[model samples]
Target: MREFLQRTLVWLIVILFIGLAFWAFSGPIEGLIAAGVALLAWLGFHLYHIALLLRWLEQPTAERVPDGFGAWHTVFMTLYRTMRSQMQSKRKLTNVLERFINAGEAMPDGVVVLDENDRIEWINPMAMEHLNLDRKHDVGNQILNLIRQPSFHAYMKNASFSQPLVLQLTQPRELVISVQLVPFDSTRKLLLSRDITSLERVQTVHRDFVANVSHELRTPLTVVGGFLETLSDMEEVDQATLSHFLPMMMEQSRRMQSLVEDLLTLSRLENSPKAVMAEKVNMQDMLDTLMVEAEGLSQGRHHVRLEKGCNQWLWGSAQELHSAFGNLVSNAVRYTPEGGDIVLSWKAEGERLCFSVKDSGIGIPREHIPRLTERFYRVDRGRSRGNGGTGLGLAIVKHVVARHNARLDIRSEPDKGSTFSVIFQRERSAEPEAQPENQA
Candidate 1:
């Protein structure tokens, strides 16, 4: 409005000046003619500016706004300011959206976005992996169609978001996922998925451990209770009967005691902080003691020999190493057949010091090797029990090895032999003359 008024005012001034000048030299009719000519020229000037405005409007950028004379100058400047402000606001919004997408991609858990009609809108990389979805092809498709699990379909249909659903997916990999749906904006929903396979495995192990413990205790308890009941019911126990049952009861009682002790040792190793490596263990003396224990356990059934390749001492808890090594030797002694060769060695290979037990025993199958360190796991349950094993030796050995920063390697072939080795890093072993600083 202001520009229009300004132009009108200028036009009137031009007409008046031209009219008066012509009137002074000529007549009123000639003055009227001059005013009309001035009006035409003024219109032409306005038309030129109008054309420039139209050309600039096609692109309508701040940088391309045309400069104008008189009122059009104000019009062009206003357009420039407005256009620049809008561009800045748009750039900020774009940055914010980019940051949001980047955060979604970086998240560890899977995130899937659904539209009002339950169509796939956006999904993070983790979501793509968890759902086995191709982002290019899966986007804009119905989420239910892609995930056709009946439970998941029912979960979506029910719209109950209070509890998460546990889904076992077999595509891409066998995965146990805990999924939850969250509603937002009165129309859209967020589907969140978390991998819980490890958690499920732990729970299963816990249940199995409880059952095994109960079963182990029940057998001994039943034996001891039955013998006691029989002795109590007798009026006068004969000498032959007493002799027959007493030793058997004592053996079962000892077995139970051993099991309890092993359980305590394993629990301590697992719960305690890393073992103190301050004590310097004499490897030669330790191996000799293990030789004596192996002979005592074998009772001339197997030939046990010690091989000391290096007399280097180790920097670790002597008691823990003794227990770990003793378990290995005892296992070898018990498993080997009569006259079988059982070798216990403290040797160096490359940059490591290894204490290994090799035996000519009925070796374990390949399938059982991976789970040998699991508590109470056995290749043959009856044979292991007959040999008086608590089934916690390897588990204890594993914990001890981990505490000492060592690795346990097991190699075996059926009917050939088996070797169990605990390999320690070079830093753990030192010569007699140069021992490491005590790090208690």
Candidate 2:
């Protein structure tokens, strides 16, 4: 629209020039012509004045802002250079500004604009959302004062254009913010923040896992070595002495064994998508074998009760289901005292198959039951040692159940014993072809 007006003014100025020339050259011809020419000259001069105003409006910013002295003069030179650059490229200044603003808005990271007084001048939508900023109250507030974090304030207070301040948002979100201390004019600063919560979480879990695993292994290893040395140099190698120390040795060895197995299982489970299973399994036969093994392991005092709710042919990994079912039954027996009973049962719940092993042993506390599947977690450390438990039994069961697209649920009270269940998402439970024994 301004371009059109500018061209119109130029045309008006041209018409005025023609009229002025006619009045000045045709003077002796006619009074009416002379009067007409005078009127045209007056209109032309005014139109020319209008042209000057249009030209001023049309001038580049570098030309419009008059040159000042000293440092101010340097700004004009820089502005002139920018103006020349823009002109050389034949780009619209308004378009450039629009693109810049659009890019700022489109950024995924949070961005903030600060004025000379270090107050937040403007913030992008991401900044508002990521920082949980209240647009109503946050704007016009000092960035340093409002964000009360010492890290942020210090960054702002001691920032240089050469070095950007990168800090984490101290808020619960723990967002990673990389702030560019872009100094525009004497006081404005631009801050950019990107959320790294997920990344930080993954890194933290990795660190914890490494530290925990290392700590868990170190103690057992020290015991195993220390006891070996003591056993070797003992003067009296009698049955009574051997009996006392042998059990402790076995306990330490077993604990180490359990830790190693768990480490291996965890490693294997964490591998690629080939963690697969597709086979026919008779859960009854599987549970029966598991029962037999559990009884043998516990010496027959564990009376296991079995009830089948599905005779359908289950399809999945035979080994994984076996391990999962075995873990549930074995774990039940392990926690159950000598005379306690373990009940192995299964059913088809809607479209999914559920296999359960319940016990009449010492039950798990409500709090401890939640972490029952965590690697190396134990309800009673003493009881776990007495039972020769690796604490990876449930963890193994969990990963197996997950591979089968199933979920494991544990229900227990502090003293009434516990019921560990694996809800199989597979379509059906496999039936035993021959009469498979169920007395593990």
Alpha carbon deviation, residue 293, candidate 2 (Å)? 2.5
lDDT of each: 0.91, 0.72
Clashing residue pairs in candidate 2 are 291-440, 292-440, 295-440, 314-430, 363-417
User: TM-score for all predictions?
Assistant: 0.89, 0.69
Candidate 1, superposed: residue stretches over 4 Å from native: 1-50, 238-240, 433-440
For 1-440, candidate 2 gives per-residue lDDT tens digits of 35445655665666556656665776534544655666677567556655644654577564574443433345446667877787766667777878988998899988888898888888888887666676678999988776776766777777465665556675646576656667776667777777666777777767866776776677778887887788789876888877887788788877888778777876786573533445677666676787678777678777777888777657787776776777777778777888888888878888778888888988877877777787667778777856766667787887877777778888888768888887866553555466536743
Provide the lowest-lDDT 10-residue window in model 1: 431-440
Encode model 1's per-residue lDDT on 51-131: one tens digit a residue.
Answer: 998998888887998887777777778788989999999899999999999999999999999999999899999999888
Model 2, residue 381: C-alpha shift (Å): 4.0
Worst 10 residues of 2 by lDDT: 65-74
